[model samples]
Target chain A: MEKSTNIIDCTIRDGGLVNNWDFSVEFVQDLYEGLSAAGVEYMEIGYKNSARLLNATEPNPWRFLDDHFLKEIIPEKKFTKLSALVDIGRVDPNDVLPREESVLDMIRVACYIREVDKGLELVQMFHDLGYETSLNIMALSSVPEHQLIEAFDMVKKSPVDVVYIVDSFGSLDPKDIEHQVNKFKDMLPNKQLGIHTHNNMQLAFANTLTAMRNGVTFLDSSVYGMGRAAGNCNTELLVSYIQKASYEMKPVLGVIEKHMLEMREKWEWGYIIPYMISGVLNEHPRVAMAYRASDERDNFVDFYEKVTSPESTIAPASK
Target chain B: MEKSTNIIDCTIRDGGLVNNWDFSVEFVQDLYEGLSAAGVEYMEIGYKNSARLLNATEPNPWRFLDDHFLKEIIPEKKFTKLSALVDIGRVDPNDVLPREESVLDMIRVACYIREVDKGLELVQMFHDLGYETSLNIMALSSVPEHQLIEAFDMVKKSPVDVVYIVDSFGSLDPKDIEHQVNKFKDMLPNKQLGIHTHNNMQLAFANTLTAMRNGVTFLDSSVYGMGRAAGNCNTELLVSYIQKASYEMKPVLGVIEKHMLEMREKWEWGYIIPYMISGVLNEHPRVAMAYRASDERDNFVDFYEKVTSPESTIAPASK
Candidate 1:
């Protein structure tokens, strides 16, 4: 087996979006301890996107992690470094403090195709501030090949350590992942490639494995398939499946047993009728999400009529 | 879109294993009512495999589906027809009454590569006896290419109405399924093709979709991902996802709301750690099943140690 692969746990980050970041501090602390024991490399605590930007009135502890709040939750840093995500234009540069004072080791920047330059600007700032940084370009399935090339050219010149292939739509197959990996390796030979996948097509786990086999380094997974739409690949799946001798499985199991099971019960994601249909039809999950959240979701006849109607294809332009 | 693809609901047959076939007559009746409302073409009510052959002492009525019990449970045929599965030799020919008198419209035969002839023998008997028969060759993943070729030659000559690509291991990817579909179509050009996949690798939904898109007519799925091992492709997912205007979503949702939610609480099968691990490693779920069954399974470290040891790989010498 190859050397231990770096696992990035995204339960609190991606999963938080499912439940509007309602995770208790106790759950977060227990998750930290469990993930650390499982030998997870990095645990993405939550998005660092400013709550003011989204205009969300919800308690924003996880939405914007503060050094004071983090120190209280986790006093000791042993295994499992902490990470936070920032979207372009959403994060306030003033919110980021000295790296030594904060509990985080990495600050990930998520952006769109046209925002690569802005994303790298944050990466550069985080790099100078003494934090491990990565630039994740979202909605990769829809991005033209040349846009990625143009983006990667700038990313190659940046000080970022990791570049991710984010299958935001969960539309990529294994072959697509391999092609992306090869493209990333050829373009930026010096930087490591990470993969973030959704299970819309039920290919998240397989796609992640394909990337690992083809030499991609970082794997993003959640526990109990708890994330947006069909969810990300399960972290418990990765730790136990990698052939390395030192790959510990208990931490992952502990995370699932303690936090994930309950979290799944409370939240509705992964393998629902709409999500599965979206995956199978190779369409986006928006329609499925709409149908699921609708009152007549269980009424198949009505659901079918609405979906097949000419108006179903022509969604309202306002949203 | 293709004049309504036929759906075979295996909730009772496959899901029965997860709950030790403890389904009450009322639950089966409700499921039948629900499946019928959802426009399911056929519902496999039970398996006719002899319990004595497996030395299973459990009172698994579905394991050995008697005609009297079948009549008692689903007395009236509704919108969907009924079917039952039988293994070669284990199924008593005398046990199967004529289709006119019986509740079952079809009787399927499942066997290994070596038992194709036996499987077809049963298929011919059932066909002559006025039952829609299907030959389901199990473990298509393990079957060598040439063996499948030879088997298909005889199968093409048989009177069976349907041929199934039984992904018993859930190991095949879409490419594999596509290749298999092309091979099946080329070999048995006259027979209708069916797909039955496990969610061991989380590809059940995708694989089924691929088959449907590539011209296979029969699609087998269950409500709420309830089936053997990691479960089958979710029927709700299929109904909601299929682009066909005739596919209804409400009956599936009703099944989920009424039965599946409660069933999920009682039985643990969906996306658990062991199942996800099996999926990521591209391995069979035997270890996961063993681990889940054991009391010490939560100790992932110990389970990892036991499975990866060199001694575990050695096959025992036998006379």
Candidate 2:
């Protein structure tokens, strides 16, 4: 069994995609406090992308992750640390300030398999500025073996301390996680390995445990399985399942009880028919998402035909 | 991969344990017609146990599953056959008529590992009375290896055609299921294997799939994962995930649309903190069930401590 590592919950950041960053400041504040008490290592406030590029008209807290706004939301640092995420072309380097001046402790960079070079650029900038950094390779299930091998060669020299195996499609089983963990160990043996999983095929918890047992250091999860599509692994599940005293189960449950229940009611994520079908077919969940948005999503035959139709081919990627 | 065989949906029968057999005849009839259209092989309408013994006070229509009442529920047999469950000492053999005269086709018997002989008694009677019978050995998780070995010696010679590897506590993993399947195959090579899994640990679907890939022929599920505690495997998920042409995705979806949508609103099941804690502790879900019934049930820390208390020990087995 792998020793207990830090848990970094990205419910707000990843789950925001489901509702277009519609979470209120109060919700975020409550979540942060609960996560702090729960002994969570990090609570990802939201994405640090510039709103101008995404053209979002909504209150862009998740899009910008302003330093002033974050300070106001989390007035005091408790047991939990703070982190923010950025995409390759969506972020501005100038937006991040010194670690002490800002509430953020870490800045994570998420990019496609092809964008590793560009993603390393952000990792270098963050590392230079004294912020702990990680480079997350997204959609790992679709990445070719050679591409990952080449990307790891470049990533090994970068300043990032953590490299993640993202199961964006929720299609991989425990064996897949084991293979990916082994590959990470062989390629970037010096850097810590992280795992992010979705529950489309109900493999998130198992796959996460598998990676952890195989020496992965970072585990990503959310409360009540709230994230994009089938949602990330449940934070509460991990906290209680792990045999570590430092990982507090109370704070994660507090978030679930105080916020995530209502959030689940408002948004459509987690296991639904369309998501499960997309997962089994190893396709994107777009058709399932569209069907779920409609009144007829529960009509399995109609939903199956619509998704498997000759005219429809592209599956919905994770947000 | 093993060829897919019959899928027996016991949403009402197995799920009734969650709510104590409170389903109306109309709901059962709707499920029967719906499963038939979806090409489900069997519909387990309800248990045939005597309510007097269990002291169950719920309405008796779908509770006891009367053969005369079963005829009225589905005037004509369709693509889906009918099945009912009976527990040791809970059923009277007189209630079950021959399959030719009754609407029920299969009579499944549930028993603890110690009661295999008694359970086989009912199986022999049901088989003699001309009904396809199965012996579901409940809670294989906690049963000692020697007990199972002794039980299988008698089970191999019984009149039962199907012997199920039941994960009543939902605490087993895929590896556990693989070991159990091998043990059952070695013991009862002449009989077919069935799988009845609970989702206390969120591995029910995966375990079922693992069993199928190994050699199990019968798979049990419910609509939208509605069953006792963490619930059974989702019927919709299994139908969509498997490659069985006999399973038409449409009818299952219709059942979800008409019944489960509103049903989900009324009851809470699926992956939750309390259930996950029980699975992690390798314990039964009774503590989780108790928490869910209490005001502090959603409190993860308190739930964890209660289930892991020194006095909690191994939960006594109950149907």
Candidate 3:
């Protein structure tokens, strides 16, 4: 096992998308304690985006992620470090507290290739605030190679501790992951690399293993694969498969038992056909997610026809 | 798109394990037509074993696969060829008809490593009957390399047209498939290779593609992945993903819509967690399948504990 290899549990942050960040605090607390016990290096509890900037009427604690609330919910910090994600335009710099005052040890900036500069700016601010930072470039499957190179140029000079290869659409196979990892290694030789994969094509765990084998240091997974459309790489699988001395599979399985199994019933996720088709076509899963929510959920052929028709662009539905 | 690559639809034969060969004649006929239209080279319609030899009282057309019944069901043969599987001792030599008198173009012999000689004897008989023969060695993941190499020496001299690498437990990943294909190639240089995969770890499609890319010719799949446990690689995925001019996705989807979707609800198959765990551990799914049948079906952690306990050997349940 690589000494620098770290597992980041993002169940609350990524899974919150499926249920509007409505997870109970008890579930969140249980997950934090479980992840710490499992010897996971980091736990991303939720997003730290500014609700006022997005003009949201409803106040969800996980969506906004107040430092005071986090401290109250998790009074004791265990071995696992805490992190949160922030979108380029959604988070306000003024709203973030310094690392010494807040429980969060890391702030991850997730952005499209076009927003790399803005994303790096946030990374610089978080770095100046005495926090570890990572820049997660979303939707690597759809990004043109030249644009990725251009983004890496800015990233290589930035204070971002890690640059992630994000398979936002769950579209990549191990072959593709290998190619991307090599590209990132070549472009950003000074920085460590991370991997965040989705299960659309049922390749999440395999792809993550491929990345790990190719020298990726940071791995992002969720408990019981609870995330967006097809979910993420399973944390239990990662813990059990990775031959690290510190990692334990029992704690990961414990958290999954305590929360994710119930969440699975209420939320429709994992390797459904629609998500798979979207993945094979190398498209975002938002379209497939919408189709699954519609009345014709079981009508796979209809969904296939709609996505592959000559006139159909099958764009992501508006949020 | 290798010219030698062929798709074999095994819905009826493999899926019969789940539904006790109870498929309606109409469904079988439609599947035959759909597979033909989709340009699948062969379809394994049913088993060719003699029920009397196995001491069975009740007779089912599919389980017995009478030539007269097959002729009635598929009076007009289309582009696709027909095949049937038989166990080593379960099939009586006198029960088989010559190719001139039967609708089946191929007779596949499925057996364990210890039954190689017996299986080869059946293959020789089928070859003398003027039918294409394939030796399907089941449970290859559990077979030792030395045993497989020894079996292949006898198989190399036999008249079998294709030898299959069967992932009976759905336990293999693409990397494992690649290694197995190379080993098979090294051992049996003259015989064409086939791949039969289960979806226990949701790697069926990916593993099949890996084998195909590494020069395996015959690919086995089921409509909507309707087989035992987690089922087989979906025929629809293979047809749509394999970029051949003869392959058409709509026909495969049509059959799935007409028959498989309804079959899915009544009989559970595909990526359930217990099956996935079995696949990950490289264990036969009979244990997981038994767990699914018990009242504690949804208790994944309990199932995991039972299977992985130090005292639990988890041998397949006796039929």
Candidate 4:
């Protein structure tokens, strides 16, 4: 059966957090080719964040994607279309060329609940510029119901083609995912829904499948789950699991064998104790990720104590 | 909420598959104490498979547990109860001491669909011996509908305290788990249901949670998912995620830190590509396990081709 599901590969974008967008041109090319051969619909090549605003001294092609650079890399595009993610205020409108002028087909705007209006503004700009647009609301687990309702009021009027429920904390189970998807569907009637998941507590694949089962169209995945903290859903798992006959697992496995296996050995990602603790506690993985970088990384009992202590429970200064 | 759920840790029993039941006495003791402090209901210590039948030269304590040895290991019983699994034709009935004489509380009988009659006979023997019993129907994904119906008809009449739906292949999703739970519940209303899951697709926790939501009581897990290929659901995840208020996660984390971390380095388990491929294909992990041990272990593309190709997929001589 042909489903409306469009897999969006986020290897270079979300996975940038692990390597600071240090993906080699060769690896990215291989990933693009593999995903295309596997019949994946779109690939979020990288962030469209501007270098001037971010004060980036580095010349990372993936961090600040240039149309000319992207065309040079993947000169001949295949079945997989291109997309790029942008954080609020990080990406300048001037940097993103109109869709027909660039290799990218979509420009996704990611934001917290408070920045929904700002996200929609970017989405509107992208939509008007002849590109598909999506507004990803991160940390849905922490957002208040009233806040979501208020955000949806603006979102419902936005020209965004897709709206995503991001499991930023990687805390949600399938039941929670079902509830969120239903809420998203109810709030955004005409819009397609997408799911972006983290693998803490090993629920990423399950949560993504739940969203798909609930009619979520755009499923976000990274090669071998190469993203931030516990990482995102595995692109290979999705390709193998999704019932759509067009989707092939062999090509995904090909890239995993040819590139990701070596990359995984060098990079730190996937299920780890601290990340699992944060997810189970429904807290952000920032503290856990920091702890993992420290010398006491394997001291999970100590880490658990430190996180669960009364002092760590206090609200941040921003609150 | 005080739910009727009982978590059974199969760390040593199922994890034995990884290292051939070579757990140190000290580690087993530590696991028992940790699980007890964490308020886990039961710990499956090891298999009761007779060494005489298997012709074992090795004195693997966990594989062939002795009543006297168990008493010496856990001299004082804590909150956590003890259990051991037995396979049909492998365990000598005479080796099982009466519940009143032995430290073990439960004796679970695991068998295939074709061997349910034999499984129940063992269950009846255990029941007569004053031991709490369970019938674990393994490789449920391979079993036909009529086979399950036949097995359940025998299972429904058995003097068993729990009946488990064992996803021996790690092939099921949450929806499949829910459906199976419903089927078990409808067929055997009087019998308590247990769930034993593997993490091949990282759906173990989600599937176990789904079963719990549907009122299945007995939940099987292993410390850091230390069972066979892809392993069982993480015991810490369940200890942290289950909101029963009393299932303390600190002790679980303590054990994982104190022992499992080093053990994980020595043995191979948890989500690997081959295990995941087998799970996605709904096949047993034996071939995948063999592939993982070969020189070309990381050659996932070759493995995918070999498994998916027409020649390798043909039935064995038995079939």
Best by TM-score: 4
Q: Candidate 1's residue-wise lDDT over A111-187, tens digit each?
A: 98899999999999999999999888887877888998898889999999999989887877777888989988999
Report the C-alpha lDDT of model 1 over B1-319, residue by residue, as the tens digit: 3565888999889888788788887788888988888778889988987777768787888778877888887777888998898987797777778888888899999999889999999999999889998999888887899999999989989999999999876767666898999999999999999999888767787788778878999999888778877999888767766666666777777777667777788887866656655554455666777788889655554555455566865211210
A258: Cα error in model 2, Å? 2.5
Tens digits of per-residue lDDT, candidate 3, B140-176, equal: 9888889998999899999999999999988887889
Candidate 2 Cα RMSD (Å): 3.5
TM-score of each: 0.76, 0.88, 0.94, 0.98
Please give, for residues A216-237, the per-residue lDDT of candidate 4 as tens digits.
9899999899999999999989
What does candidate 4's lDDT look like per residue over B123-215, in tens digits?
Answer: 999999999999999999888899899888888887899999999989999999999999999999999999999999989999999999998
lDDT by residue (B1-319, candidate 2, tens digit) is: 4345778898998777776666767777788888888878898888898877778776576667787777777899999988889989999777778878888889999999989999999999999999999999987888999999899899988989999999987888887899999999998889999999888767888888888988999999998888888888888777776777777766777788778777777777777767877776666677578778888765666665655666754343543
* Preferred candidate (TM-score higher): 2 or 4: 4
Compare candidates 2 and 3 on TM-score and give the better one: 3
Which of the two candidates, 1 or 2, achieves a greater lDDT against the reference?
2
Candidate with the greatest DockQ versus the true structure: 4
lDDT of 2 by residue, A148-175 (tens): 9899889989989899999877888777
- Output DockQ, candidate 2: 0.48
**Each candidate: what lDDT?**
0.81, 0.83, 0.88, 0.91
CAPRI-style quality class for the chain A–B interface of candidate 1: acceptable
Q: Which one is best on lDDT?
A: 4
